[model samples]
Each structure stands twice: as C-alpha cells, then as structure tokens.
Target: MTRLCFLKCLLDSHAPINLPHNVEILVGRSKITKIKDQSCSRQQLSLKANCDDCIVEVKQIGINPSGLDGFSLKQNCLYKVGHESRIEILLNNYIHLIEFQPPPDNFSPIKRNKRKIEDEEITVKKKKCNKTPDKDSVLSIKEAMEDVWESIDEGELYIYTSKGVKSSKKIAAFDMDGTLIKTKSGKVHPVDTNDWQLAFPVVPTKLKEQLENGYKVVILSNQAPIGKGRVRIEDFKKKIENLVAKINIPIQVYIATGKGFYRKPTPGMWQTLIEKKNDGLSVDMDSCFYCGDAAGRVANWAPGKKKDHSMADKLLAENLRLTFYTPEQFFLGHSIANVPMAKPEFIPTEVKTEPFNDNLISDDKEILVLVGYPGSGKSFLAKQIEKKSSYKYVTVCRDTLGSWQKCAAEATRLLQQGKSVIVDSTNPDIESRSRWTSLAKDMKVVCRCAKMATTKAHAQHNNKFRELMRINHLPVNDIVFNTYKNKYKEPTTNEGFKDVIEVKFNPSFDDEKSERLYKMYLLEK
Candidate 1:
C-alpha cells in the first residue's frame, strides 16, 4: 500500500500539502493533486496563468509566478521537506475542492537527507530571482527613490536620485526644463526624447561639485503637463532618470504636477523637504539658493533666444526667504542682466482703500463697471467692495462666465430681482464697456465705472504670476493681453457712466504668501 500522509488542515480551497519525498504535484483551479509516478513519464501539461486570474509563487525560492511556463511545485531535497521548517510556496489565488481525511493524531512530518543535484538547481533559480535589478528593469522612478522622502501624500509623487542626503545648513535647488535642459528641436516645447538637449554642459559639473561641497542638490520643478495628461508620468520619470544619469550626480527631484501649495512661488515643496524629509535636520535659509530661468526679463532677441517666461522662479526664492540666482548668474558666473519690461511704472498708492459706498448711490440699484487690463486687480477691488461695503452687490466677471454676453445675461437676470450687480472684467475698450452701459440703461439704474490705475506692464506681470501659480484656471497669456491692448481706448465720460471713480490697483491678501505674490505681480524692471 502507498503510504500517504494527508494534510493536517482540511483546505476549503487551495493550501500547501506537505509531501514526504520528491514528487510531481499537479495544481488545478481548485486543488492540488499528486501526479502518479507513471503520469510524470509523459509530458502532457501546458497552460499559461495570468496574474489577474492566477498568481503563483514559491516563497522559499523567492520566485513570483510570471504567468509563464516551466514552473511548478515539486518535492525536492533543496529545502528538506518536514525539516521542522517545510518549504512554503505562497498561493495567492482562489482555489476549490480539496477533500481529505485527518491523519493519525501522532502523525509527524517526514524528513529525508538533502539531495545534491536537485538542491543545486533550486539554488541557481533562487539566485537568479534575488539578484540586484539592472537599470532597464526598474519600472517606476519611485522604486529608485526609495529612501529620500517619506510619503505624506501618495497623490503627490516625488523622485530622488541618490540615497537620501540630509543636511541642515546648505541646499542647492534648481529648476529643470529651461534652466537645465532645452529642446533639441530649437523649440520652446519638447516633442520627444530626440527633442531634448542639455541647456548647459556645465550643469552636471556644477551640480556634482555642489554635492561634494556638503550641499544637498534638489530639483524643484512645476510639471503641470503631467497632471494635464499632456505627458505620460512614466515617460516623465524616464526623462528625469535620463537627465540624472547624464548629469552623473546624486540629486533629489520634486515635480509639482498641478498648481497648489507645493508649486513654485508657494514654498510648499521646500517646506515638506525641510520638515519631513530632512530627518530632523534643519535648513539654514541664509546659505541656501534657488536658480531658474523665468526671471521675467525682456526677450534676448539674439539668434535662437527667447524672453524669460515669467518671474516665478525669482518670486519662489523670495517666498522661501532664500538667496536667488538666475541660471546665467549661478551657472556661468555672469552678472545679472538688465530685465526688460514694457513701460514700467509704479504708484505707491496704487490701490485706494477709501469707502466705496461714497461712490455709490445710497438707495438706488447701481450697475458697477470694472475697467482694467487683464490682471489689473479689477476683480480683487470689486470683491473687496462687495464684502466691505454695505452695497453687497452680485459681482460677475467675463472670464468666469465664459463671455461678456453671458456675464451681461447673468447680471440682467440678477438685476431683475432688484439686486445690484457689479460687472468685474478688463473692460479695456469703449466697445466692451458699452455693453455694461447699455445694460444699465435697460435696467434703468445708475452706471458707474471703477477705472483701475494699473499700467500694461503691471497687468502683464500679474498675468504671468497668475498663469504660473493657479490650477484649473486658464492662463492669461501675452496673446490674450495683447488682444485687449490692441483695442484699448481709455475709459471716457461719453461711455455713459454716471460716475467714473479712479480705483487704485491695491490688493491686500491675508497671508505672507499672498503679500509676496502681490509684490511679484506688480514687480517690473
């Protein structure tokens, strides 16, 4: 009679069956059936197992099933069966139909002497599975960045180059795209890997030198394209990896895919790195410096050159209370160049804080018109009046409603309910402002225009700041700003405004971040 020892536990589904000798075990969807010695003589079994349906792995060998072939459980002497510690192959799949009777109460696992040839074969397989992964096999960027930063939010994924480098005193933060790399196509935006080229050959040498000088080199970049589905996350990760390899230096990278606190100029990414990732070490703000290309300077106009995109990088440094450097100044040791702007002007009392009710009719419904450039603080002023003043008017802007006609329709509907309305928009030209004046005439209310004293330069600066910092909001680019400027006709008395109050472009936000942002929005050279 064949001496068979049944498994101690009755497997409701699939469970490990500790066998006594070298045996071929056949596993079906439900149960493990020991193949007879006669059946093993003929090669008959072949099937592919997808992980989604069935996942198999031998825990002792550290081998996870890859849904391929030539892998199966066998009673081999490599890890002796019932050596008190039996070879455990972890079954990570649903199983069914296992019928067996209990063994004798005194039953004990059988152990046999280890075999030489079979054990050597199993050892080779284990070594192949446990070896260090090569570069190409590394799937995600985070896998390589294992230790640098502890995840506070999995939604905001970040990558690091070397082992986590913690330093309290010094850090060198740089921006990625234009500052470090540019398109090979000689275009502003990248098309593919072929389009990428190093911005400066000195970048790697400089960064490596910084790393050796007791400074933690980090890349803080805004990668909104990743959030918008314009760029694949995996491809972006690979791009970062390629850059790091090319630079041949250990660096940590933080990419802000969407605009939020962590995005540049907000200082959230820096704050996280310092408080969470620095391993209780402190950052010396005085010794740290940030570098980027968006200094908002005028176009270089030279061959194969472009204007600074925005002043966001400088503003980001300002917000962090750290020393700031342009890419030219930091990497090339060049002096700061003259930043160009279109007719720069500044008025200290740009924003008027006086009572807006004084400009309002006491008991009559009024149609308040806001007239300014695209980013002239017009919306801010209108909202301020509606909140502080007793007017409590319903304010609407064309940007929010999609069009001027839509805004007028919404305002008309609200006015019919005996509510005062404020039309907040960059009513730059007479034709644009006429819609409001006409609406007021139809509503039979007094029309008042709050003309903001914000210059074109100030508006453009503000536009750049908003475009870089805001999420889900459409960017108000030079094309849109210039479109408005082309038809701008300075608000006039003939526009039918009962009273035109000169509203200064002052905005007071509650926090330092907002205060810093306000300064950046108005900053011009």
Candidate 2:
C-alpha cells in the first residue's frame, strides 16, 4: 500500500499523530498501532516535513512480491525507516535507496599549514641574505670616501675599495613638493590622492627594501609655506607623516623652511644633513647620495660653472668621495641619457652703436623703452622707474592692442601730451624696436632704450623661484636663449636712436656688451 493512501486512511479514521514525532503505524487487519521514540522520531519528522514542503508530488510506490529488497519509487518520495526490516519493507515497496552524506570538513587548517610553510621559507631566505648594517654602524670618514664614484657617458662600474674590504651601497634622496607632490593646481584637496602616489608604485616598495638593506633613505625638501603663512608647521608635519605612512618606510626627513639657506638649488638643505651627520662622528660622507626632482637644484650643485666646492655634494664627492643620484636616475634605475647639455652660446662681444639722428626723439618729449629677455627683471625695473620718475609708463602688448594701429594710436596720445612716456615691452629684436622708434620719430620725442640686460641664467633662476613661490607649474623652456644668442639682430648705426643706455647685468655680461655697442651709432645728416 502506498504511504499517501495509508496516511489518508489514518486521517479519515480521526487517529491523531504527534506533529513533532514521526509515527510508524502498522496497518494490518484494519488495526493501527503507532510506535514512537520522541527525539529521533522528531528529527526524522522534521526532515520529512521539509521534503514535503518542496514543490514535488509523490507518484507511486511498488513492492517486490518476492521479499522486500532494493526497489524504486516514481518521484518525490523518500524512504524513511528506523530498522533494517523496515528498510527491507520500504525496498519491497520499490523505494530507491538515496545515499546521504555527512557535512563537509573545514579546510582552514590545511590552508594555514601551507601559509606557515611559505612564511618559514621567506624568513629562511632573508636569513641567508647579507645582514643589514645596524643603526649604530657608523661609517668612518675614510670608509665613506670610498663610496663616491663617477658615471661615464656610456655607463660605468663603481668599485668601493677601503682597507681591502669592498661593499657597494647606493643611497638616493628625493625632494617632496614640486618634484613628488604637485601643488601647482593648488593644494591637494584633503580627499584627492596625489598624482605622484598614483604614478610611482615602486617608490614605496623599493624604499622599504633599501631601508632594510641598511641604505640611508632620506628626504631633503624645501618648504617655504611656513614663512609665507600659507601652512602651519604642525599641519605640514602631519602631511609629511601621512605621506610617509602611505610609503611604509622610515625615511629621515629634513625640511628647510622659513627662508633658511637650506632651500633647494641652494645646497643649504644638503649641507645641513651632511653637517648633522658628520658632527664629531666618524661618518663617511662618500657613500651618501643626494637627489632632487628640480633641474635647477641639480644644475646648481653640478660640478663646474660656479666652480664652487662649497656645495655639500662637492664636499662629499671631492672631499669625502660620495656619489650623487637624481630622482630621474633612481626611479628609472639607470643613468639618464640626453640630459640638456650646456652648449656654450655665441654671445656677441661688440655692442651695435645707435645712430645720432634728430628723428630719434622729438623736442622736449622723452621716450623710455624697456627691453629685456623673458622674466629678466624688466617689469620690476619698469615699475621702479615709474615709481621714481615722472614718466608715464604704458604697457604695449596683448593688454592694449590686437593690432599695431591701436598701439600707434595710444603712443600718439602719450607723445602729444609732451609727457615722458615709457613703453614696457620685450623689444627683443631690432624690427620690434624700430616700430616703436618710428612712432617716437612721428611724435618728435627723444627716444632712449633702457635695456634690462639680465642674463639667461638669472632669468631662468628668477622664473624657477617664482614658480616655487606661487606653487605653479614650471614654465615652458623658452628657446629664446638659443635664438637670441645665435640670430639676434642688434641695433646698429643704420637704425636711428637719440641715445642707447646699456643696462649692464654682470651674471652674463656678453649680452650687455653687445647692446652697448649700439650706442655709438650716428645718423647721416
């Protein structure tokens, strides 16, 4: 008989079965007796209840006439029996013996064991490697001397030889602000990640490795914000702490703030670090490395030019024999090729003489012509002259005119007033200067060129300083230095000028001398 039919009969007879317990009722000769073991029966009942709740209907149950053995049910029915005899009876009813498995074992212990092995291997490998010099292992001044080495154009090998003991250790220093953290677009909003953090993934990782290898990892940065009152000292400290944490390295950080000599491109910061390290201590300056992202900083301390050995790098390399590295070399892991070579420009020795022509200036009208290379103190000098002199200063550039006609009109008005007019413009070439000179002739004013002959080096230096102060992007490299040096046309005897006052800037005097020669020009009657 099917279990469903037997259940239906039991239900019709009004026989009550415990909902918590599975009832095994013997349905023979129209008598029903229920057997129950409360605990086990309850569990079995729960399982069967859950199975019944699933979306499946019991189809058929068939018994094998020849003795209850393995049998099969149609669908959705599960065989449940407490004894072997009952199981045999279920088999006789053609119920399938579906196998049930116990719950799976947790695999955490196996995974943990594998991880332990890997960790042990790593530790063992580290142990086999060379021991990092202890923090107390102060290098002798002589030993330090062995660390300085030179790089060749086509790559070179550095051999550190001291007392027949040779070991190579490379240290690389980095600048923080403009080189690493770009503050140009303004302060990194407290939320936005720094671009350097995004670009150099290997810096932090490699820094940690270098630290572990007993290499001195240091940062020599110049922060002028404290003096400018833009950022508080504590806030700057916190920002640096945050940067260090992200890098996961214990880097010795030195900040030159508040107009101290330690600012970058000045060698003060590097000097401070070296002096501090070398104070009455047997420390080798040779193996130490100094690096910065600023080209000016690198160029300032670079051997030659100032021929100044007062630079910390020079003291270390020449005196202590230490090597230096730039960020370009460190991050790239190779010497940089195609660095801008300082090609000696052809600076004219002779100044073009200005013509002594009556047309150069009109009666009782004075003309002040401002002339200089880009950022060569021209604007500042002009401003100073405007403040001191009674001359009315006029800037003639994109601000006043879209065309030359407008410029001429404004010049005409200033000239007609018989006022001492100053034109603040970059009259780099003779053509541009001639246009203004022609306007002066038409106005019948006395024309004089106040050349702001600041050297290319000085102009570039001022520009870099300004960018740092303003936290602005570095300006594009002006090819004017090369252009003017090579193809610049000087004002000569042919071009009319009442007087040419040469502004001598000593940093590079060749340009001044070249401009001064123009004063001797005399106009034809």
Candidate 3:
C-alpha cells in the first residue's frame, strides 16, 4: 500500500480541494455532522497510511462557493496530475472528499532530466525569433549624404592635404563662368561694369577672408573657347586679370585651353603648381583646394557632358588630402550677395533607338560591342548608348574575366534574361571581338559594334587629358598608342556586325561624314 496523508478544512459549508503540487486528485460531496465543540467542527481532519494509500488536502469552506478562495473551482479551472499518481472522489451532503496516489519507486530519473533540457532549448529558440533587422531602418544614398558638410563653418581652421603633406590654411578656389560672373547668350557680362554690381562683391569678401586667414587662393579653370578659337588667349587673360584686380584677390591663375594638362577635375593644374613650388616657389599645393561646378570638359557635347570626377574625388580625398566641395556647399559659409546667378543650359536630349517595325530580327536578345582605343571616349559613348538605347551596360572586366568559358557563361545568362547588353571593353583584337560575336550567334542574339576610330593624334592628345584626369601613369608604354593606331581593324561588312558605326574627333560638325557618324552612333539603334 502507498503511504498518504489527507487534510481537510471544516467550515459552515463543504469545499473542494486545491493542492500546490501536481497530484492526481479526486473530489466528492460529503455531509457535515455536528460535533460536540464548535472549534472541533471547524478543525481539519487528517488520515495517514502506508505507501499504497492516497492523500488529499482541502483548501477552504464557506456558505457560498464564490466566497471561498481556492475551493470555488469555477469554470476554466485546470487540474494537473503528476506521474505515478491516481485520484478518487466520494460524494456526500454539503461535504467534499478528494484522494491522491503516490508514484511507484521505479520511475526513471535520466528521462526526466532529458525532458527538462529539451524544454529549455525550446524557450531559447523563442527568444531568438524576436530579434531581426528592422524593415524601415534602411537608408538611401541621397538621404545618407544630407548632413555630410553640416559641421563645416566659416573661420574654421581648414587643413588641405596634397602629395602626402598637410597644411592648416584656407585655400579658396573658384569656378569662373557661373560662379564669378554670368554669361548671357554666349557673351560674358562683367559684374562690376554691369547693373549687378552688388552681386559681384562676394568675390572680394571671399578673397579678403582668405588673405586674413593666410590662405593661398588660386583660379584653376578650363577655357575651351580659346581652343575652339572663339576667344583669343590674350583677351581671356585680360578678363581674368581685370576680374582678379577688381576683386582684390592677388592670386595665381592657371588656365588650360584646347588641350593642356592644367585643368580642373584633372590634377594637372594642381600638379603643375606643386612642381613649381618644389622648384623653390612660394606656392603650396598641400594647402590648396580645388572648387569646381562641372566635372570634366566645359562643353555640353555627348561624350564630354557626363560627370567623371566622383571616382576621382574619392581617390583625391584618400591620397591627396584634397577635399572637393560643390558650389551648393561652398555658398554655406559666404554670402550669396556676390554670387552670380545663372541658369544651367538644357540642350542635349536623351537619344532614342527605334526597333524595326517589321520582324527582321525576331529574337529579343542583342549584343552591343563597344570598341575604341584607350581614352578614345569609349566609356562615355557606351554610357550614352546605355542611356539612350535599350541596351543593358555590362562591365566585362569586373563581371567576367578574360577566360573564354566565363565569358560564354555570362553572355548566356544575359541572353536568357532577354536583356540587350553592351559590352564596354578594349576589343583591339579580332579574336576578342569574335568571341562576343560567337556568343551572340550561339544565344541567337542580334550583334552590332560601334567603333570609336578617332585619329592617333586625337587619341594621344586626349590621352594627355585622360592621364591628367586619372592623375596617374599610362599602364602601357607608347607602344600601346602605336599599336592602337596601326593594329586597329576597322569593322568591315564581313566582321559579323549587323550594323557598324564609326566615330571620329570633329569639334565642328559641318562635314557630311561627321554628321552621318553622329546620327548613326549617337541617335540610336
């Protein structure tokens, strides 16, 4: 028999049992008999037995079930029974009795410990599910850069770094056209001589601040009109000198016209100053800063119009300690009273390529091959094509390697996706171009090549500017230029290009060949 102990609470009414431990318990009704003493009638009755017997505990008693605490046993009340426990119930008038059984001696301890471990593991997993990356916390580039220059203030000690030297001095550089003066219908209106005299005083104030701060302010600009013979070099020089004298910013000025190294966005102008200082001059490039409105060439030509200095700015900030500030930001410290107000010219429209009205080319896939000598304006043209045409510009150097198998795999992927892709690379050899043509054929895609065949002299002249823009050395020797000139195979009718267009360097577009090239290459497919 199982040993058990039973306890009962006597009151005016019978009550159910409520036990703390999980035990198999049963309850029944019983009658309350009057005892000799009132205190004895209210006392709990207990029974003790051996191991085989069951035990029960009464919680409370009252006249109304709602008045009792534990013995109310309302709806939704739950009872749990432990292992090796049994319960019994007995019914009587206005009295309740309950019984519980004891567990057998052979219960397994190891299984109970394993069950506890499993329960703890489940609890830990539930906690981990609550932590994750918030959906709304992601940021875009423009918003992330909103407060980029908020900390900069006037009179702050600005340090400029160039060629590994750092200097704490204010170096002010100004862009001429829209910054210093306004140009109306191709004619530059002098600020002091014009009605906008008050607007021109900002230059003098900026210059005065620089002088007070012991700064070396300079003008590094590109005067392309001189190269085009629209403006004489002497006349341009006079205008610059007159403006500087009027502003009272006694500063050195470097202007690059036509094809020169010292130009903004290109480090040549800054590099030239640094070299001059190394020769015992007083100029300091380390304490110099470059401010410009446009990225590269001044003209709004197709290839020259795109911005190129974002990557260059990143490089300059890392290597030269030179900070590039936009005009919108530079005006934060200075007053806008002297700043020239000019609206940006909107001329060039996006090119559009129309598909054949009929189904001459039924396959939706197409391959666009961009061919040119290094710095022959290939990337710029490719970008224009990508923007204007329906061709997806795919970078082969970073995406696909020189290996034939890898190239084939990537081409197949693009073709399957139904995207017309433009491959921008130096495809100087027939074998390289042939691989792209073969991929197009295998994938049933239409293939075309837009060759940039600018003259070697033109490419070389542009190469100098490109080198300046890169502020680095040419990867190959002069042999690369010679090879590009001599070894270039003009795309012929047999070269597998469904359509082949050639581009040349022509600042003036009066020639029929130049006009045709522009229409064919720049217009669209």
- Residue by residue across 1-525, what tens digits does model 1's lDDT show? 233332322122234454332334433222253323332222222212122212112212222221101112332212212212212122211212111224333446453322221111111111232434332121122223232322223223354444434444688999888899989887778887456878888998898888888888889888766544456655776687678778877677787764445667657678766765565567888888999987666666333557776666876776567788877788889776454533224332243444454554335788888887877877777777777656558888776676677888999898898878888887888888898899899889888888877777777666655543442233354666788878888787788988788876665556776555555323423
> Which parts of model 2 have CA positions greater than 4 angstroms off?
1-216, 219-363, 392-404, 471-487, 505-525
288-344, model 2: which lDDT tens digit per residue? 565544332324344442222113332222222345554546666756454542321
What TM-score does candidate 1 get on C-alpha atoms? 0.56
Write down the lDDT that model 2 would get.
0.40
For each predicted model, how many residue pairs clash, with residues at least 3 apart or on different chains? 4, 25, 16
Query: Which one is best on TM-score?
Result: 1
Ranked by TM-score, top first: 1, 2, 3
Q: What's the TM-score of every candidate structure?
A: 0.56, 0.35, 0.32
The global C-alpha lDDT for each of the candidates, from Candidate 1 onward, is 0.58, 0.40, 0.42
Residue 237 of model 2, lDDT score: 51
In angstroms, the error of model 3 at 352 is: 34
Q: Taking the tens digit of each residue's C-alpha lDDT, what string does model 3 give over 1-525?
A: 533433233222333244334353333233433323332223223222233423222222221121111112212223322332222121111332233334435544232210110010111111232323232111111111111110001101011111111122355666555455554343344322222222244667765676668765656555554433345444554565456557754555555552323333344445544543233344544666655444322333233343322222322222335665544346445343443333212111122233322221224458777677776666556555555544454434312254445656776776677667667666776777898888888777788877775655445544553332332323223567777667667776477878776654333234564333222211000
Model 3 scores a C-alpha lDDT of: 0.42
Among all windows of ten consecutive residues in candidate 2, which has the lowest summed lDDT? 113-122
User: Candidate 1 — which residues are off by over 4 angstroms?
Assistant: 1-157, 182-188, 194-202, 297-306, 337-357, 362-366, 373-446, 454-487, 506-525
